[model samples]
Target: MVIVLSAGKLILTPTELLCRLSSGATLRALPDDIRLVTTPPLLIADAGAVSWTLPLDGVECLDDITEFYGFAKE
Candidate 1:
């Protein structure tokens, strides 16, 4: 889990991600459910059948998330 007071929570499991990003929305996804791509300041993720751009702080924190989910890091 990555939790920052200025940001929010990002919980990663072998098969899932429970994320409440800095955008103030609670979200969830499973591995392979959709692609998760991290830009410098945003996480492009999927919610249900739709996709959302979730704001995330700190590149290091974002890196942890992508790595855990088996996505290639930049």
Candidate 2:
């Protein structure tokens, strides 16, 4: 999935979202009324208004780097 973390905003793909959950990221289920069986990150969808503050340390952001360097000059 393509996830862009530019300007402190999270633009994630459906597949990426699932990846985070599987990786054990924390999710905050705001608003009461939501029913969830597991508190693990994988079960975030079950919780209503799922929220998480994930660190994009290893995650790559294409916007931060150039895809092709010195291609035009070559």
Q: List, residue by residue over 1-26, the lDDT tens digit for candidate 2.
A: 23433223332332223223444442
RMSD of 2: 14.9
Clashing residue pairs, backbone N/CA/C < 3 A, model 2:
none
Q: Estimate the Cα RMSD of every predicted model relative to the unseen true structure.
A: 3.1, 14.9
The TM-score that candidate 2 achieves is: 0.22
The numbered model that scores best in TM-score is: 1
- Give the total clashing residue pairs for model 2: 0
True-structure lDDT of candidate 1: 0.65
Best by lDDT: 1
- Candidate lDDT (C-alpha), each: 0.65, 0.28
Cα TM-score per model = 0.64, 0.22
